[model samples]
Target chain A: MPDLGLEVLIKGNNLGRLLGGLWIAIEISLLSIAISIPLGILLGILMTRKNRLIRFLTKFYLEFIRIMPQMVLLFLVFFGTTRSMGWNLPGETAAVIVFVMWGTAEMGDLVRSALLSIPRHQYESSESLGLSRKQTYFYIILPQTLRRLIPVSINLITRMIKTTSLILMIGVVEVLKVGQQIIEANRMSSPNAAFGVFLVIFILYFVICWSVSMTARYLERKWS
Target chain B: MDFAYIERVLPLYERAAALTVQLGMEGILLSIVIGLVCALILYEKIPVLRRIVMIYIEVSRNTPLLVQLFFIYYGLPKIGIVLTPEVCGVAGLAFLGGSYMAEAFRSGLDSVEDIQRESAYSLGMNRMQTIHYVVLPQAVSTSIPALLANIIFLLKETSVFSAISLMDLMFTAKDLIGLYYKTTESLALLVIFYLMILLPVSIVGAVVERRVRYAGFGT
Candidate 1:
């Protein structure tokens, strides 16, 4: 048998450091998710409006965000704006900003589709019952929309959490970054540290994302 | 923002863009093959292979490509398996995209009515002929939107190829930005190049989706 270099993780403070890094990634995504939900609801409502310009703008923003990869957006926010605007933005701040922009667009789209999916007859039936506009929305439309949105938004949460891993590339010192640092420190002592460290990071990500997606699936099954 | 700077970096971006497209196309093709194989295995309900494919789909779908890239590029060498960065990039994309493509194909396959397969069998067609002549055409037609979306997705994911030191578009933009501090110029060019590569594909995908709907293939 050979040295697997798994010991590097047990070596003092290494695993702790990785966990701390994971916390940062989690913090960024959670912050964006918190901010995104309300703003996304607003954007979603705006997207469904009959106005032409608002529709065009919302459509354009969605398409533009969809077309641009999040990595490029990260680079643009982290590196591009700092120099161009002379603003000193931290890596974590830039990560959150970009993630918010992305999450809002995605969440907004999800909301729009969910709202559209409500049949026209539902609204007609509500009006026939002599419910006020606000009452109809509060009573009928919102609840169904919430049901459709919950599972999908849970999926977006997982996507955001997984994508936060890319923030390491911008020097955010996230889990992957911390893992790389440990691997570098132990390179002479542990030739297999890369394998060990990356495998651990991969498992860490898998566990978090897997649980989130599992929740989404459970809700989808229960609801449908 | 800077016209002259953009002009100077245009050649670098062009070369990198070519590599990105090449890598993405190769990865998409490979992923389709891998995905189709897995989907078929699941569709046939192969006992042991079904379990393995299910596990593969879950693991790959849950993990990020960045970590997967790190594993293959850095970790595999530890156990005496070495792959060039280009190879690793393609492998990573295929690994990530394969699960998605498999899900898409599996859904399409599931949507095909069982009555059609039985009809083909009653007409004296063998299993292979039934699958090839009756099932696949309808399955693939229904899967067109998902497959096209996956293709665009795989292409966008190529941005992370820079992590493995592939000289792809993202790498070129970062290199130029670092050297000149011309962030706007570099990033703008990066976005333009990506759009050039992706926008047409999406437009074509939309057109194809519309055509398929009109042609009543999936229905």
Candidate 2:
């Protein structure tokens, strides 16, 4: 507060607005992740399928998502879709759509790599034990995949949270947008409002991600 | 299916594509330098400085690149430091790339065993010689895939430049859209332009990763 002198957050309704913005960011990220993980995992597993067509389609989607920026994706879903398809989606809905799409691709890639990291001998041993493909995947491969996947997938969660900030560009009134509004409102009295607001936003982000990473470390050890 | 508008905008797209490449490459190179320096500092492990470096890495990594860009571009002026959009965009990207690159570099350096250093000393190599002749090549080779991937990620991220009017591919696409209002077709073209760059880099990334793996620790 001394360095930033942002106590004006207490003087007006700006505090509530900032908190509400944080809440919306959290809400969107949480909902999107909830929706994405299961579907992404399925896509990841299906990516490893022996069917050439399945791999081809999954690869196409992954490559598309991988190369494109999330900002562009946001524009595509928010502005492009409405312009083209006449769906007239809300900004928040468009934000969720973009996050879910991006998250699923990221998580799918994580799952694929975790699956790839399984030592070949493990699969061989399972095959030698007369396990069917489904049994091998279910009883053998999946548990290890999940264990490896959990630690790495924590990365995607934190990443989604951070990327949610970009929703502001698409006119979603998220935390950064809230900070902007706060600063704009008080710029006459406080020229340094943005400095304080961004510093706080940075701290909030650090805390959220730091805790997530700590839990990831704990899970890695626990699973190990 | 419709080429008239795309044809009209082709020159603008080409100019923006060139600028994107320049920005991305410059950002990538600077970040590699920053990452190497920061990683070395972290490796040497000064107490207070190490703590500061860790905080920088964590804050940069945890916060969104957009916010970082905004802070650098918009918030800095409040403190009487003004930067052009191009400068801010590139620096912001460098910071982002540098943080991740530092992580990769540290792990790469750490993977070089102390025993290797000991062996180098036994072979009459000095510290610098050992690091140069033994450690760095091994470390760089092992981490090449990660380093390349981060560069690609950074390149993709430069699309955020569109927001700040940095005149990159996304910016050009936005201009095209502003003119023609063909959001669907033009945005797809934007993605295509990115794909043209990224897909080959990724293919090379995969090839290098496999060769590095097959070549083993001698690499």
Q: In order of the candidates, what TM-score does chain B achieve?
A: 0.97, 0.93
Give the range of the ten consecutive residues with the poorest summed lDDT in model 1 chain A: A1-10
Instruction: Output the number of the lDDT-best candidate.
Output: 1
- lDDT tens readout by residue for model 2, A79-169: 7899888888999999999889888888888888888889988899999999998899899998889888888778778888888887787
Q: Which pairs of residues collide in model 2?
A: none
Give candidate 1 regions above 4 Å deviation.
A125-135, B215-218
At residue A178, give the lDDT of candidate 1.
91
Q: What share of the true interface contacts does candidate 1 keep?
A: 0.77
For model 2, residues B157-188, the per-residue Cα lDDT tens digits are 88888767788887777777788788877887
lDDT of 1 by residue, A1-224 (tens): 66667899999999999989888998999999999988887788789989999999999998898889999999989998898889999999999999999999999999899889999899899999999988987899888898889999999999999899899878899999999889999989997999888899899999999999999999999998
Per-prediction TM-score = 0.97, 0.91
